[model samples]
Target chain A: MALLIAVAADDSLREQNVGQSLQERVPGAATVDIHGLYRAHWRYLVRLAVLLVDDTPSAEDVVQDAFIALHRRSGSLRDPDAALAYLRASVVNLSRSVLRRRQVARKHLKVAEPQTVAPADDSVLVRDEHRATLVAVRALPRHQREVLVLRYWSGLSEREIAQTLGISNGAVKSAASRGIATLHRVLGGAPDA
Target chain B: MRDGMGPDDIERQLRDSFDARARAGVPDGAMPPPPRFATAGAAPRRHGRWLAPLAAAAVVLAVVGTVLGLQSGSGHHGQQPVAGPSGRQTSPPVLQTSATAAPVDIRMVPVDGATYGVGMPVVAYFSQRFSSAKPLVAATSVTVSGKPVHAAWYFEKSAKPGYPVEGHLRMRDYWPAHVDVHVTVAANAITPATTVNFHTGARTIAVVEDAKHQMVVTSDDKSLGVFPVSLGTDSTPTGRGTKVIMAKQPSICLSGPGFHGCGIKYAQQLTFSGEYLIAAPWNAALGLRDTSNGCTNLTSADAEYLYRHLRVGDVVKYPDTTGPMMQVAGGLGDWNVPWAVWLKGGLIPTG
Candidate 1:
């Protein structure tokens, strides 16, 4: 059953990539080997999506959609080597879409059942310490979360994060600082080193 | 003593939490199914037979001119391209490419939208080994209840091959009950920028008695209930000290040396080692008889009530038992360990 799910996900990603490759045009630009690129980067991209969405199924969908979007515009890129950058940007944008949709659904659910607690199936089994840390991370503001995730989780440089999010490098730095400071305060202060 | 955690510590904790969660959520395997889209780019090619030869001649002239220019050293723009085994010119150095590959995979512990016990901490993990921790520490941030937290980051060294180094974050104290926590790591600082949100649930604690054969429950220090229970036999004593509720089930089948296909209802597992549970036994009278192996038997009504109210990470203290203290990592029983011992078990080295 797990294997089947994985295969289905892989196929979905490839189909999106193929669909995208056919849509966008870059006149006289070199055509990238979309298959090779997909093979190499699909897992990594999905992991990125998982961090953003916090679920495997949604993360897979997010990454697949990003590849398809990249494929559509792959031909128009001024530099063919910039394909990875484009994919990363697409993934981030699509993940936002997923989160926005989830927020809407949650709002509706809240309206329908104001007093009900969240279902238990929504959480994964992990250590209490880890769970607390994640809670703190999730509580950060959207921009700050993006910057922190990109900086620490993705290991992207400040400039690269700025480019991906279409923000200034200085903004990235400040957002990150504020975000970390917020985390420290929210987590009840860091332990003595 | 103040926890003067610098950027490096925060970076490490973030990396550890993210990596651990990502590892759990995403399976390592082949990609998923392909997407469906219209074949929009399949247009007929224009016939350009005459231009083919001209294009080849232009390419040949350009290659000759480039070689001559390189020999003269005047037209060499940057690092000279070397000839490969196939006799083709290698491409020039890519200036725009980053020095270190971005961390494409990440895992955050507790996951997004998860409700956790107040003792939980925020952790993040990345797939890339960090050479410089400055940018990561500067760019990543965490907050709880609209307020920032002073979180320490610890670099977690990986034990398995192919697994990337991890980062872990923790607060000096446990989380406040019923508060939301937010984490933000800037885009490109890790992979792509992202945010995580999770909320802490109510606070709960359990007091168990092996000598009196009873238990008491409390929420936020207010007494909730007191019920009778049956503890372990003399030979197979129940584990003493504090243990965290690791999981719960509506019903569980009891099997092992002292039992005969007996079923337990409303089972709440107290130990991480899976040896002990606080549950209602098949026979209600067992609640007053100390005949079980290692489990604590309770009445059906009380078991169901406690099971419904208890949350993972709630403390279950065996205050009156002579058994050994729960081991750290033996389950979620970190509370059983001494303060100094607990600090030593941290992923980060402390002063």
Candidate 2:
């Protein structure tokens, strides 16, 4: 408990003058790269969002909103490294709101459980074991999918994941434990304990 | 590394199939039409589902000063209806017992006037285990800001003998901020009878987004401030979890890796493994890069401000980062253990 850490923070400021270069970055993300990165990562993000939101159009909307939020928040970012993460987190949050909106919309419409997402003809669907797995993954609760997808897709650490999902680390661990358990069973890889 | 237990194969397929399907669905240049320019000001989200840590105990040893053996155990077992705090909230009730009256003192971790965060637990320390916790358990009661809470007792497993057996207690959820916790333990027999009190300060929680190098502090659904920080480096990564402030020090010496220095100011300890939030004016890349041994490195000015404003038991959460997960027993990590599991107690059994 007594092993004191020798590391310090202001040391970097003295040795390397990185702040001046950071100023150049603040204005850049606000204009050029917001559009550039949005266009570049749009397809990838839409695809990822679709897995959780369960459709392409809604997923696209979620990504767009996320990009716009990122643009607004980018000024505070000193390092460009945080840009993608901020985008990923925004998407996750926006996806939750979309899900909540759908639940309300469904209740208002008195329609089916809002499952008209998968395209039918030449449906972006491929029939195979992976499809079955994907179906099961999608069918799982949205929060669980958020945990699994963020963990598996974006490769975020549990800490970053909690920030992204606005949940606790313990909740993250619990969701992962339960999600992984269900996936093992769904894929016929493991039986009940 | 996935802490505790996280399987690899299932996670790999989740990625593999996701990547394949995404590529198959969207061919070259098939991006959706650019979104409308309006609606950029995203509505602020109200985090009603904000899950916080268990109550942080700031008065672990203060009870020892007033620990007095109340009386011999009548052996009612585990369910002891404690005598309510007599003369509730008039003048501080002065117990009529000597500190050394009992062989083993029943100490409440309720520091008389210290304030902690919402997640602070109401803890009791037994110098030695009674035949059962009943004698001590029944003699204890807790009220938060004058409202009675049916707080139950969960005994803890000491790391070793002579380390004081603990009876941990908390409400169903994290405590609300700006409340006072009055814990009265009348250990009539096992050891001493003492009533100690502690305050729950603001429900302050700091979430450190590692990638962003931003530490955001919030209290009661309001944003307090955002400070730039440089977290631990790859070699000595900062472990992640919902951690509580265990202590504060004005100045301390810290040495890790290639550096060794003293006069480091405004140190607030997070974990027992030497993780801290401290002043590190030496790092040029305060928010640009990870540089410290494992502590959260902040500017000296920020550190001093936080040291003064933040109290022991205030929560600081680190989402999954490059580091490992924190262990429940590592420091004031009781909050990391799920509530249901926490209810089951540790070492000592309820059933």
Candidate 3:
């Protein structure tokens, strides 16, 4: 089930009563406080950003920037239920911008270096094949890569991915299918008879 | 590693892969400190609004100062000073032209900071068509990792009659992966000064042999793997030379003259014409004797392995061929054309 976190401006009566049913269902999941929201979602959001941007420092920066933006705009969002969605969207958008900026920096900056893939002990974490999969996924087109990562990594359903990407449900489905097909081909998997 | 698995199995493997990578990367730790946010109902901070205008005034003063300095420095010339439209005595027209030859407005194709496939050609668009390209070519240089490479500028005409012309620079071969390209367009007789930088990601090259019926794959010059393959028949020979992997498909049905619903698996395109591919025959043994409509056929396993590893920028070279090599415009066929021939492809007219 998706988590809904309300970010209200203050602990006023109007804010309290805004989503009584959702509040009871999730039990204080809605947070009017930015710090509280950050404390709650920072880790997961950072991981998500890491998957998208492929680096921890940039990922953390992206997540932190997302929170700062959210905090600044918390007063404007009437529906507190949209807070988590806003954060997710912001993270994705910021990640794209980071990649774009990185691309430009790479072109002009002499200090630019290719991102080194951290070598992990195979016995402790990923198999060679799994790591290969990750590399292949990184090389996919942006839309296809985003859809695949959201669907498989985050376990978000097609509908959720569609909402997160602001694309249609059909687009999500096609992207997922295409991404999977590409992955299968890359991974040396045989087609179904 | 089982056969007949469907998309669901692939999805499960992908999920497992992503989870494993995440587990290795994200550590279990306390949440990092968040940026300071405005307290409950505090107004957001606003900086000075007049800073922009102040900066503009400073720039104007600097430009005027430089122009006046130039005029004074040229005052000793015996020629009479020219009168300006505003009735002020200005520097000679020649000196003014030298000072105000608007720095060539240069826009590099790929812009600054674009990641292109290995087949990308560095193109520079000039605001005006250059009368001579020798100065521009002499001043410009393309380097990889601070080391220079053989690159030449070809003048490409504007698509529309009156549109500005462009100079396209290309190396002799496809770019190696993960290398930074530094482009310096120095201020020269034909164009103004500009610098462009770009990067190529992960170099994957596949060499195919029709006579030997083998395909070798390499990443960053290290051999990843090799596989036996079937090449096109005598009637339909695969074109030779270099091609970039354009696209991939898991399975596609081939249909045309003299062909039925013949299926190919793990198909990666090599030509922009969509005519040739490196794929495996559907439901057939991979190493079977050559029989294709000008495509290199691989085993399903090999095809999938390549599909997983090869990206859009990766190069595929056909060293042995029964037919002529493809043209430069045929799918990233930049490597097929020789450096001298490629140099002539640009807009500069030969004397």
In every candidate, how many clashes are there? 105, 40, 15
Local error of candidate 1 at residue A145 (angstroms)? 55
Cα shift from native, residue B326, model 2 (Å)? 2.0
Residue B152 lDDT (model 3):
71
| Model number with the top DockQ | 3
The better candidate by DockQ, 2 or 3, is: 3
lDDT of 3 by residue, A97-171 (tens): 878877776777746445323223221334456666788898899999999989887888888889899999999
**Using TM-score as the measure, which candidate wins?**
2
Which lDDT tens digits does candidate 2 get at residues B214-309? Answer: 799988878878999999888678998888776566776654433446789888878755678999988888889898888999998889888877
TM-score of 2: 0.46
TM-score of each: 0.41, 0.46, 0.39
Error of 3 at A149 (Å): 41
**Per-residue CA lDDT of candidate 2, range A106-179, in tens?**
77676655453334321233324446557778777777888988887667799999988889999999998888
What would the per-residue lDDT of candidate 1 be over residues B165-253, giving only the tens digit for each residue? 33444456556788887777665433455566777777776788777777887788789888887877666567788776654556554
Better of 2 and 3 by TM-score: 2
Instruction: Rate residue A36 of model 3 by lDDT.
Output: 49
